[model samples]
Target: MQQDIRDKFKNYKEENVELSKNHSIKFEALLQQELHQNKPKKNYIKWLSVAASVMLLVSIGIQFYPNKTSEPIITKNDNDTTTKQITLGNISPEFNTIETYYTNSINLEISQLDLSDENKELVDSYLLKIAELTKEYKNLTQELNTKGVNDATIDALIRNLQLRLQLLQRLKKQLNEFKNLNTKQNELQII
Candidate 1:
């Protein structure tokens, strides 16, 4: 199929060559006229001046009519020496607030639960471990912030929290199971 197409193209080229030879004089004159017209004119300086003026006007227009900001231009000073305002870019406040609320809720829930002294001591130790872990997490987070870590650290921290949360859930489940067992044993003794 390709060879057939190539043969057809070769025939077309031969035909075109023959046609071109017959009209070569007329073609040459037309080509010369086109080339003369296409060549840079004596008015090149005038056209260049016009183009430069247009570019200058466009530059001036850009300086004046820049794309309008969606947000207000919060300026530090009247001079164009101001910075762009990025909205709510920092997450420290939101993170801190949420963490505080979550930790407080956990503490409150733990305090409201009744348990034996032994179990209470165990829970206290677990809480202390969590506190230590949280402190270390905070220190690491601060270090990452100082070193300009990417959002990967945030993702890692979230994953760690998820793991910790799973562990805590398991601990709570076990604690509940232990409490139920203890209650049943006490009832059996009473019986």
Candidate 2:
């Protein structure tokens, strides 16, 4: 009975060894197939890198290429002289106001007469402009007040507007003085 048990154990060991060998062969074949499939992917990545490098080099070359020729458009016209050349003080209100004030004052003193139609017209024009500006400023202030303006900013804007209004009033007074001076001169001339 003991001899039969030893033979049975030996047969079991031989079968286990054969089964292990077959499993090892199958695993090695699976590994080989996986490696073969990955080999082409490595080559594809290498080719992709080369292609990208070539495209980058071509783009850089195009950017550095210089333009061979270019020209500006030109036209000639005989009537171009009709346009007036505007100097610095040509349309400056500050300068114009000062010039007009001085000229008008001199003319008034020389002429020595009551307000003429032209003089009244000039004064009225300036006053109307001032009144318009004043009304605009008032409306702006009212809107700002309704919108809850900052106190400090409101004060600053008000101060600036007052200064502008003062300047306008000063201009008006200067013009009136010119007219009065003309009237006085005319009275003196009569006397």
Candidate 3:
């Protein structure tokens, strides 16, 4: 069968049959029909690309969207007036963590303090200083709320937090020394 087909092809070529007037147009039409049959697969990919772009745009939009929860909340106080709190955390998440860390550390130091009758005067003095610093911090916070965030205010706020922590640490150290000296004196008396 292969030999017969080959022989027929050779004979036809030798005959040199001329093409019809519209042969090119007919072939192009058949080719287009065949190509169109395969085009649905490409169309599916095109739709997929469109869908992926839409999804990408939606994701980007969501990423850039501002969150409502991050805004400051106003609450009514004992005087039946609303007050909005502002802090370093209000500026950014990093500030919030820093503020929280320093505040917690200060509280932890205070909680760990050893209070006794002998150290009462010393404790009162340290507490008074801390109270003054606390008052100053509140004033700075008010400044921040009124003036908005600036390099000076932010630096001052962070510096204030650092000072409070340092003061607490020094108080702890002095109390430790005072207790140690009292122990040595007690030993000498016992001897």
Candidate 4:
């Protein structure tokens, strides 16, 4: 029985089968038909996407475009031959009042300082500090013009003014103390 099973296994042979030429041609035709059927759908989707993108870009451009009628009129000063600049004072009545008040207060504090020969260096140092603060204030004003009124910038502008006034007041007080000290030293020397 074992010899019979071995003989049957040795006699078995695998068959090599392949698709006929006619079936191969039919398969290729079916594949081309499927691709042709889907081509229009793919092109339609591509054109639809491009059209949507163009509409989106046009809407964004429209939103960013400045309106000519609402634009501010900028008139050059004839006498100075310089362009007039805008500031927070021009933005609103409330801001104008606040700006005017701070400016006047800062000027008053500056004018009250005793800028004698002895105190010239001290005064100059304070002036330099004030000038730096003024530059920062100008930057804040430009920011306000570009970004419009916001709490952070408004507070910064006001704080800059306050700091300038405080610096001037402190300088004045120090100068007065220096004068008193000098007067006392002169009296002691004479005695």
Candidate 5:
């Protein structure tokens, strides 16, 4: 059927066809109408883009502003003295960099966790320990502010952060092992 159609088309000859006298004029009018219609859409998109840019600038500005309540707070103690709660990051730029790196990594790991009923118990136990460490970290920061900076306190704070990260890593490793073991058991049952 396709071959017959192909042969018929091959045998066909071109024949001139006449267009209406007003065809070019109508086509030009249509093109003008389309161009005018398209222009308003482009302007709408331009305004939308401008709005997005303004919002982005405002958001970036807000990000740079210091957040007061969620973090270290200033408390006035004794006679006419304001003392801000001390933190590891506030201690030094180096400590701040280290602390930031560890915090970001820990948060990233937690965010990526694959939570399921199979790993709930394990995850909960590890999280409980992390919570305890977090409390201890807060205590040590308080101690640092109260008794002033000590080598032991600094070391303990650093260690606490290390332990939290390590616990998350261990939890991840155990979850992977559990999944692999379960997969193998299912494969065995299938056989």
Candidate 6:
């Protein structure tokens, strides 16, 4: 039985199996053709990637580039004093006085604010409101310039300044209250 199995194995090993002569050649040709076909596409992709990178760099540069021209400064020459022209506040000395008073008071209040880190956010919010009012005031000034000084415009301007000062005063009081509350809480915690 062993001899018979060995003979069968020998017969199987000796069987002639003829592979197609063109099989490997055809495969090689197909591979070469595919490589050639993809060459241009790879080049195209490479060029596109480079172009996209260049565009990205250019856009970023443009966004971050500093402006070249600066605003011109106008200086007054005291020695060459000509007759001073009357301007907005010059129209009414009382209006100038009111504006100066309110502005100085608001500035003093701002300077006195507790600018600690804890109060910073609150202060910033108050400043934002003041800035908005200031913008409105600027618009009113522009209107006054264009329409020439009217009582209503002057009143609005003064009112805007007053509102800014009042806002600052309120913010100061609120901050003080907050500080006092914090102090009391700290004391309680200690006790």
- Candidates 5 and 6, the one with greater lDDT: 5
Total residue pair clashes for candidate 2: 0
If ranked by TM-score, best first, what sequence of candidates would result? 3, 5, 6, 4, 1, 2
Q: Which ten residues in a row have the lowest lDDT in candidate 6?
A: 67-76
Summarize candidate 6's per-residue lDDT along 1-191 as a digit string, tens digits: 34677677765756688979999999999999988784444578889999999999999998777533322223346888643332345565566667668888999998898889988899999999999998998898778766877889878888899899999999999999999999999999999
TM-score to native of every candidate shown:
0.42, 0.28, 0.60, 0.54, 0.59, 0.54
Off by over 4 Å in 2: 1-118, 142-147, 151-153, 164-168, 187-191
Worst 10 residues of 5 by lDDT: 65-74
- Output the lDDT of residue 152, model 5: 95
The true-versus-predicted C-alpha distance at residue 70 of model 2, in Å, is 72
lDDT of 2 by residue, 1-191 (tens): 34777677776854443466589889999999988774444578889999999999999998766423212122335677432322112223443444345434534543443346747776566557656655665665455545544555345444445544555555567677887898899999999
lDDT of 5 at 173: 92
lDDT of each: 0.62, 0.55, 0.86, 0.82, 0.86, 0.80
- For model 2, state the Cα shift of residue 135 in Å: 3.7
Comparison by TM-score, 4 against 5, better one = 5
Better of 5 and 6 by TM-score: 5
Clashing pairs in 3: none
Residues 22-138, candidate 1: write the lDDT tens digits.
Answer: 597998899999888865568989999999999999999987673333233344554766644322123444544444555555566555555668587766766677677677667
Best by TM-score: 3
Across 9-46, the per-residue lDDT of candidate 3 in tens digits comes to 77674566899999999999999999877544457889
Candidate 2, position 82, lDDT: 36
- Please give, for residues 72-114, the per-residue lDDT of candidate 4 as tens digits: 5355688877654556565555666777788888899888888
lDDT of 3 at 3: 66
